[model samples]
Target: MKRTVFIIWLLACVCTVRMDNFTYSYKDAMRCKEHICRHGYSYETFYRVDANEMRSINVDPHSVFEMHIAIQAASNGHIVLSEIPNPGVSDPVYEIVVGGGGNKFTELRRNLRRNAKSSVTTPQILSPIELRGFYIKISEDGLVEFGREGQALPLISFNDVDPLSVKYFSFAAWNGVEAKFLYDCPIPGDTSIEDIPNSHPEEPKLTPTDKLKRTLLMGRLPSVPPNPVMEVKLGFKLTSFRYNTLDSKLTTTAAVVVSWEDDSMAWNPDKFNGTTNIKLRQGQIWKPSFYVLNSDGYGAMDSTNPDTISLASSGEATLHFQTQTQNYCFDTTTTYSRWPHDVYQCLIVIEPWEAHENIKIEILDETDAKFEMFSDIDTVIHNEWQIMTEQVTLDSAMWNEIIDLINSEEVLNTHLSDKMIITVDLAKNPDLYNLVFYVPMLVVLYVTVLFGLMTAVMANVLLISNFGEALGKSSAMKQVLTCGVVRAVFCLPSMKKAANGDYSVQEDEDSSYIVDSREGVEEMERSDKEIKYGDKAELAVVVDKILFVVYLIVFVGMLAAHY
Candidate 1:
């Protein structure tokens, strides 16, 4: 499965090349007042992957060319469509940008400067498939309007005071997306369009596919359960996911397939040349729109691809709702408080936006298992976190009560009568944090306490000369420091002598830290009259014992909290 990529901005300097694959149908035109307006000149082309590609049609006013063009493109890349009145010189151009630089907006620009923008209607404009159509019109008064084929209002509009006549019309796709642009669509009465491959013919007889759709009342909704709730199966095919630690938001990318049976839409294969399926788009038949109950302020559950609804001859209509969503994670404080070792459970609640008394929502039994299996092999960062479990459950009663509560007060709202909740169990991987931060901190704390312990135990011997002589010069200490066997043999006797106030050194091994015996015999005479760091230094060394105990306690507490 493809992993979700973080949003990136595209530079103006991004280079583009011409696409090599191009297929065209007959020139589509309708006879207008002064000239012929081309309606459908279909072109199917494949853009090179990741290499920003540019394509254009030169609508020279001097020649007999189409002034208006319709484009139906399928892509999830940055699209910059511009019209240059003066083609050669690159200034003072009108531009229409969609999904620019991976952001989700449609912009209208003058001279490459943004004038207005709106939310992009389509999602997953990445891959080129199920091509849908739109129209762009350049009015006579330097005004431009663009919208989907049948949309009443233009999605993008720009009016220019100093406008030039439209000449070079171009569109470019950026950032590794392969795009398909279909244009020059035939108007209602263009017979030449029939020559195009797969162009639906005006058949005199209705086929089995047509008959089945007619019987099912393709555009209407199915009736509610027949004294029995009609169950609709919903399942998720998770492609990838992303989590933002800063915002505590989780974005899930899944192909949510919904299936239902409409008996009238089905037919036996023997009567229809073994025809098993016929496809439809979103609005052509009754469809359900799923919404995220926990939107986290950016509550959008949009279809990545708006095309491709499959209907089997059995009257079963299945739609692969390619949804990409950004949701607010719940109970994050209770889940994320433990830092690197934290485990969180986020419930992604999905509810059918439409309310019906007869329809019921259901969760596929294998949904959790399938999601877990996909998580294991998905192309996400391996050592970051794990999707410990995935569970999808139906919550009809809960949603019903919630809807009632929402409707109790005087307010206008649209809520689900039934809902499906997917539980995602998440846990962080703590290995890297432990190795890089926790272990080093623990070692430093322990070493500090150990140094304090040694200083407190041997202050007189190792620091000030209060315990008669240095522990370094004692025969017993030398044996302990140099040889393990010798130290073991003399360990009990040395301890016994120390208890008797005899931290004494052997004659041959006698040494002092205060002054050297042979070279400082005179210095020792002066040292008898002068003392450096006497009682104050001894008192500080004695406090080390107390501090050592306190330090050990703190370190123990720190360890307890860590685990």
Candidate 2:
């Protein structure tokens, strides 16, 4: 009877235990107002509850209390939610009872429209415990089930609907404990819109005036005017020019040949003239061509194409020549004489001068010899006076003799007159100029030979005087002979004894015996006495002989060199 009473008490305790679970009724809580329309439950049905309420629901201590939702697409359609699987959960357990005494579900449905545009009905209780501990699991087949019963339902379906249509839904869970949910989607491609065309236009082109202004403002200007024309004369007789060493004095005769032009297209007047009232003012200009003759008699004309030459007064004129004294050499024979063997040439120059008339030149001499004439040659007037040349021959034998005389060691007493003189005549002309002359190569050769010979003679005299003094010294001569004898007798015992040690000779009583055994005693003593006296006498003879032999050898070598 006690066991039966215990069984009855256990049954009463089990029945008295609070089955706090609740049911959600779909038919009673939710009503479909329109056919073929999308519908969903309020997303806020889930909420958080405090520890007391969680304990009341049999939740484990220290475990995160969370709300879970399960959603499945119904036949011919799919159910969409504002949150998916699990959503944000916080402390303080709140209830999600559908059709309970609170309006929390209705308020949640109103907030659902904020995230999505679709209309939603109040959630229904599908089972006896509609608000039980929510637990949801998703399988690889995209099927959702709730609780342990494993009620499988598709999260997406396309029965009697377009297959490309996508059904997107979400759910949230609220518990009295902290929990979290994450939402993710594929990153979208960039498609930012840009403004339309017609916002910009092209710029205008620049003008010539603008370019000019730019250049001027930048401090740049146009190029300068071209160079002006210069006038000169050509063709002149250059004479009376001589080089006495490097010094020069000369005179030149140029005949005035005027062929001038100005901007007016008229020939230059006889002289510089001020402009007439009707004539345009222009500068004076002249250009003259003068011919020069080469040794072969061929002539070429050169002109100052743009230069002016004018006379101070249009009358006869003459140019005077002067210069400082200088060292020089001249040969009239090589310049004026036409000897084929005379290969020397001379240069004469005429310097620039103002225009003159009637140029008269005179050649002066001790004998009063004079050659005066006018330069009638037409090819004479150009720019400044310049160098010209003439060639002549000399008597080769006479030239060689003079060179030898200058080169001799003996003093020479010759005057300038003893040399040669060349005279020139230049008649006065309207145009006269300056002149110059250059020394001929023959003269240079003469001077070079004289200098070389003087050097050689001085060297020979010095050597001979030194040699004579050396021969005169007696002691020096004695040393030479003694050295010769010593060389000849080097290996003899007498020489060895005399060089190394002293020796003495002795006479004994046996028939006046003579002891001569000391190596070179006799020879050394004899040489010592004889050398002193013989040195003076023999030195002259030796020196004379040596000199004779040296001279002979030198003579032979010189002959060979010449051959």
Candidate 3:
């Protein structure tokens, strides 16, 4: 009895199984190639990344492309794409490794650089003896995703926001491994879907069960979007926010609640047992393509995307996602001015991968764009960041592709463009910066100013000379910049350099700082006639008073700009 109950429980769980790309092709417009022999098999190409020779193909930036790849070796194979086209017979030398570690493990690379420390692992995903089908999708917005026969999301994906146009591609295999490729569209005459391992895998028809999937997939292909326009309602909540002072990056974690109505799911109640509701696995049905325009990695391909959909007999479908994105702060310049008091506003753009003509994203205002949860800032976020509930907003925006497609046609432009923007407002906790770095620096600054005042009043030349030569004073203050503390450390150098109006302390390319005047110290022209010591003595006093005023002006200016 326990074993039978366990089996029933397993059947109730959802599995995200998305269909391959073949469904995206228009049914009426899809015309098969003519007069081709199925067994000719002459068109099939065999190559390897580990091998010396390979095949190159061109990619379109404005369109979506699919590829069928088969590798027998469990842990090895290669798919190299070059953004920079080659000079004549050779392919583009610059390559992005989309798939270097076959089915069991794979790593995406930017030229020679590795994307992450961990490899994407799906053990024994490919059969050791037979060719298993996988689809590589190259879409607009610089998104590249590959789906295996049985997987929830794209197994290997990469996205570059301002993506490079793929101009060349090649297949290579490490020495002992050889991969089979079937690149052209339209299979040869009368070929079975199973034989062509690179073609779209046929969808399996199964009865409804809670664990593996649903009956809605029986006669429909969810991978294909509805014609004309499909409206998707979005509910967004920013669950987490953190900023890295070092990387100048804001790590944002959010939850998006989405709902839409699918016409195909409208079933009659009398069918059986008042079948009014069904909850299925994600991969087995059609779900929206969620992409973050400013994602640090491949947009929709990352872990934050969702698949679970709840379907009501009335046609309403809902899905949920817990997303974390490493985002670039649009307002980076403000960080330096505000410091502890800085309020950071980072833009999070979410959109469908499909064009505007196919899908539309509608942001619901209530569930707070679904952002209302942020109002209780004390609970939503735990970092040093203070969530500004009032400033948090969600609005409609346009995708880069749609923006480029826009022109002077005002009337025809209505109901076009599909994008949603979420702006997260967060303030720095001043208590720490005020207590740690700021207070100490303020103390040193005032002490140095006081010393300058005394020396100016005394008119002591020897004291002024010591002040310029003292490395001890400036070194610690210079450390206030702390390397990429970005570029130069705004520090107070020696009284002598200040005297000459040469108060420039520069950080070297390697992040090491140096104190130098307009003239080099070692090569410094020190002749008394050239130095005019008495004149400098008078100017140093004036410079000290000017610096005090300059510091006040800068501080006030920063406050005015940031608040």
Candidate 4:
């Protein structure tokens, strides 16, 4: 009855499984490769400094921690056991090795602090067989015990070594040898032998078909047998967006989330026989393509541009890019009162090119993603709370004979969707104009126009009218008269015979009667050959000089401003 109740309670409780140890074996490699083939993979997920932070096992100064290591001899190579120090620490580093020199164990130590002491030990004896196993016990006080499991006494023991300082342990097999970690557990110092379980659970093994699928998905195999199907489940969330009036561009930031169903699915080309050729980089399999629709025009984003946002990791990534504001539906006449109903839509698609078989990729509806646009000061300007979901699946066996089609230039233009796959509705706010700055500018413009008009009228009166008469008593007007008179001799008109013109010109030397050309009329010349009209001609010359100076000044100023 107790056992039954315990089982029921266990079944009713939710369990979360978190990996805390790096128990790598051949099976682990197969699983890692399978993940790489079907989905995106990052090596940092395995060995990054932060990746194993949460997985670190706390070591008390006086506790017994047991690490079980197993090595199966390969036909050609050996296994190595390495101890990596905590990311920031550089002390108490070393390694214990096996299966390399004449089937005997070797202990390698290096980079020890000047005064640091270690008591690490190794097994002395080996069975002629290629397989070997050992359990290492670390004590709270830094004593290390090394021997085969279930042995009454450890074959080797190190006393007073600070094993607690070691951050983690990694195992690697070279050539043909296979290194496997069987178990890692902390045993109480006072616990007896009978309290521990006799055996621990092992990881599930992969079948031959699973191995083939992994290889094919990774593109490790050049080709596969008939019927290949791939399915991907994906979703995305818009984290941020905004309009930049300075650049006249709209910037959007989004987090694209992707996942896959646990079930193994495949497609047979023979059944759904159609062909569509595609080329894609393995990294691009999970990348989400963005399409923007706005007042400007419709087009795919510039994914090749440096600022064209692209971010990707194992399963998700954050994307950020700046697009033009005209790309969205906008209205210039709409004010803040009508902005509540304004909506802008953007399309997103996730597709990869040209698999020889049919594959279906679906974007799920329950993504709960929203796009929000904020002002430069982080004031909310627009929000896209609704996302329309569309799942598009394209398949055909039009596989190109060439395997490395990634080099093709046309791949850059390829989009995941021929039609809109997913649409997001963005509510745009009315354009915000700063009246404080603009109103002042408008007032300044009106004042400048009034001042310019007044200046022009005054200058025209001064330059066009009789300057000497207007300022008759001014000393400059007398100077003007004198200057005009000095040049009056050359101002005399050259003479021409009758040509039936209205104006007549008489040569100063001839003093002959000259006829005005237009009416064939003749006017008697004065007795003096060099006739000069004193004050009237002098006033005209003064006005012309003033106008030329003013015009020259205005022309040079305009040219300087233009360049």
Candidate 5:
């Protein structure tokens, strides 16, 4: 049983090997032929071990088996071997023409020989059996070449086999030997020869390739264009002046009213809102008006030349005018001394000769020229007016010359021509004159007298020699006198005491006495209480004793002189 099993396993192995070595169809075999032919136009073939069959036998898709087979060719129609063939022994010889039946054959054969000789160890050529099917052609010239039908060049192998290892049997035939030759005759499964050309032709045309490269070499970009320009025009005028005098030191009040317009026809109001357009127009006119106001005073009135007005691109119009006036009242008064006083009430009228849009008037007086006055309605409307009349008092004796001059025919005649009117009446309160003019003067005089009396009393008190004595007698008197002296000397020089006691002569010197006496008294008191005695006392006593002895000596000398 063991032997039978072993035999069965060996037979199975053999069957697998034979099956793997099964010949591939000529069409299928052409795949390998095409692969090797891609290396060059021509090559050599040898029968040794087949690498193609080995792939099937191993059932290993990645199997790499090669056989070492040598091939050599010469530029001349001869062959050379690296190692000498068995001496005197006949070696198989063959001749091959690559690319036979085509013009490329000669060139192919030459290139194959050149490349084979240049290689380090000639590469092995796979046999035609391993390649499936190949064509062998014999020419009348005795040249033999291998190829596939319709191929431009022959397919040749470079060595006997893979030149590295072998996996199956392969074959090569001598030129004159009897060997089976295979042709790639069309079979049912074979693809049409025309299809082959359609599948792959000569290297693709490079024009389109070059064109694409050029397009990529350069690049893409963008574009630009042109635009427009703008133009503008401007106009100006003054608007209005706002006077702010409450926080300022201005003594007058006035208003400057101005209006303006933009006359530029090109100005598009639609571009601006209604309010904005109005504001812009006003601004154009008023700006110039404001500039004028800044250059002149608020009340300045002047005419601008019509031609000076400018028109802007926007259509608008403006005009400005000004007038100023002031109003105030003042009082006037006068006095008289006698009867027969003639007082005159005169009506004075002033008016503008030309019609004015506005007018103002001002009057000033220094006398109590009492008179009735009111605007004459009609006269004012006509620009004519008068100073109304009222009775005024005058003392004929005191104002005799004035009354005479007023009564003169020349004056009366001049007034009548000028339409001046005058009237008079008896003085009502003659004392009013004195009260108005003299009362304040009398009050001032009385105050002066009272001040003088008080000053005299103060002076008398300050000058009294017994002031200090009086002060010593009564505290009240002392304070009064001291206060009086202080007031006279320092507070009120008007109340200064007159020259009386020694104090008067020494007043200038006595000024320093108060300071000096106070200092001296303090020093004397300090000295009297602060004396010290001890060892210092004994020293003082010794000094005194020495002084006493000196004094005694002096006294004796004086006595001697007396004797």
Candidate 6:
């Protein structure tokens, strides 16, 4: 049972290469207007494993091609694989063609459907077992192998075809017909039919004599694997604490060091079934992994070959990577002076897939990989004296406690299982500060408060006193006693221009001229008396202005003390 479980687990950890297909059909041809794939007559076939990485299939003159080809309904068109120096030119191109019985090179039945459904169900040189489908493979050595799609072995093998005649290999077709075709290669390095089958073992294997007995009994081998499982690792960490702060970005470096012992007691990545390719899963919010090692020693993760991370004869290998976060100087949620206080936590993470086939991995977080963010709000404090000072500090223990919680295993697992979190709480309003710096200004403000209160009381008494004339005269004279001589001179009122012309018009429009003249003399005397009272108004305005100024100064000073 233990062996059974290990086998199951190991099977799950295996990662396979993706197979690419080149198809030919009516709808596809219309999309490819120029009979070209993606603007090029031929596509540069490559597969992407990550956003920053891609693996391409290396095909040279010696490479061979094998694929399953099919057709929907009988048509005049044919499937052609050829090399074209210039795609448009019809010059005698080196090519291989497959079609129904009418062709002179290789003959096939006219009605492929009838032949495929016949009782014999056997592949032949002139008639393939399947009506609309067949299997074909061409080697660089001029060997062409052809058979039915589901047949056990090749029905016919043709030899002696020169590969040098064609410069490049491409798939194309003529006329109209519905068809399907795709390459069988999946992983980058795999090139042969046997390599794929052995690498991707889908079914349980049987002894040779049992397999022969089964083939004799059923005439075919089983096509599916018994069990399939996928394996993945836990997580990765930051090993270095030395972080660099450049402008608005914060950068930190980390490495994944994996080691193991072999039968010869030699430690290496290969000894542990390690490939140059190391697959990693990361949180979406985190930045893409930046490979650290340059192109040297054993191939780094960033190498053109991403399959391995190896050490040069050393016991262990290190896969170094870094994370640089922007706007790291300030909380993303809060900027300087914009808010009173803010706290933020930014995470850098990397995790690999589960282990299988005796492969083991180790993740390190030596730096603890975390830091706290505080602004001027945290540094400056409003003291009991209401002065904002830098002497204030927060409890170091509280900060340590928070850090401990962050580094805990539970929290780490929570983050790895969920999306990454980068958060900033809203800032609290800070205490407002004062701009007062001089002692005289402070003393003057206090004196103004007392003086203004006294003046207000005296002014109120005069308003109610019926000692109006005396109060008015004293109010004007008081400016002199109040110290500033220049201010006193400026406070003196000017006759400026009597309230304009309406009085002259009133005199001219009088209906009883004689009586109006007698009353007008009396009215003129009253007007002079009113003008004298107007002077009292001017004095009141002056006194009110002084008191207002004094109150303003006192209010500012007191507010500063409280802050």
| TM-score per candidate, chains pooled | 0.44, 0.16, 0.37, 0.26, 0.13, 0.23
Quote model 3's TM-score: 0.37
Clashes of each: 10, 58, 23, 19, 35, 17
lDDT of 2: 0.29
Residue-level error in angstroms, candidate 2, position 270: 17
Best by TM-score: 1
Model 2, 1-563: lDDT tens digits are 99999999998865643232222234311221111222233232221223333233322233222223322212111122322222334211111222222211212121222322122232332222232222322232322222311223321221211111111233332222111221111111112222111111112233443333232224322121111332321122342333222232232332223212233222223322431212111122122222221111223232323222322222211221111111122345433343222222332222122122111112222122111222222233443323443322223244346557778664332311111112232222222321111133335446755655565455455445756445545576546544546324332111222344533222335636443457566765765454342233344444444555655675567556433
User: In candidate 5, what residue range of length 10 has the lowest lDDT sum?
Assistant: 222-231
Tens-place lDDT digits, model 3, residues 296-325: 886563444434577777888877667777
**Residue ranges of candidate 1 with Cα displaced over 4 Å:** 1-230, 237-239, 244-248, 297-300, 331-337, 343-345, 356-358, 366-383, 388-416, 438-563
Which is the winner by TM-score between candidate 1 and candidate 6?
A: 1
Each prediction's whole-model lDDT (CA): 0.51, 0.29, 0.51, 0.39, 0.29, 0.34
What is candidate 5's lDDT per residue for 202-261, written digit by digit as tens?
Answer: 232344333332332243221110111111111111121122122211111112222223
Clashes of 3: 23
Q: Write the per-residue lDDT of candidate 6 for residues 269-343, one digit (tens) a residue.
A: 454344222222222111122222211122223322232332222322223333222224244533543323332
Cα shift from native, residue 256, model 2 (Å) = 12
Please give the ranking of all candidate structures by TM-score, highest first, separated by commas: 1, 3, 4, 6, 2, 5
Candidate 4 local lDDT, 1-563, one digit each (tens): 99999987776552311121122345422222111111211111111122122123423335445454444433111212224422112544444444334444444333321222232223223333322445665666767666554455665566754454433444443333433333332232323433232221223244444343343346433233122443544443344566433343444554443333322123332332321112224242333333443324455444332332121122222233333223332334443444344444454433443423334555534323412221222232335333333444333222221213645543333332322244554554323333444566567657755665666566556645676346644566545444534446435343344354322344465677654445422233332334433344455554555555665676567556433
Candidate 1: lDDT of 483?
49
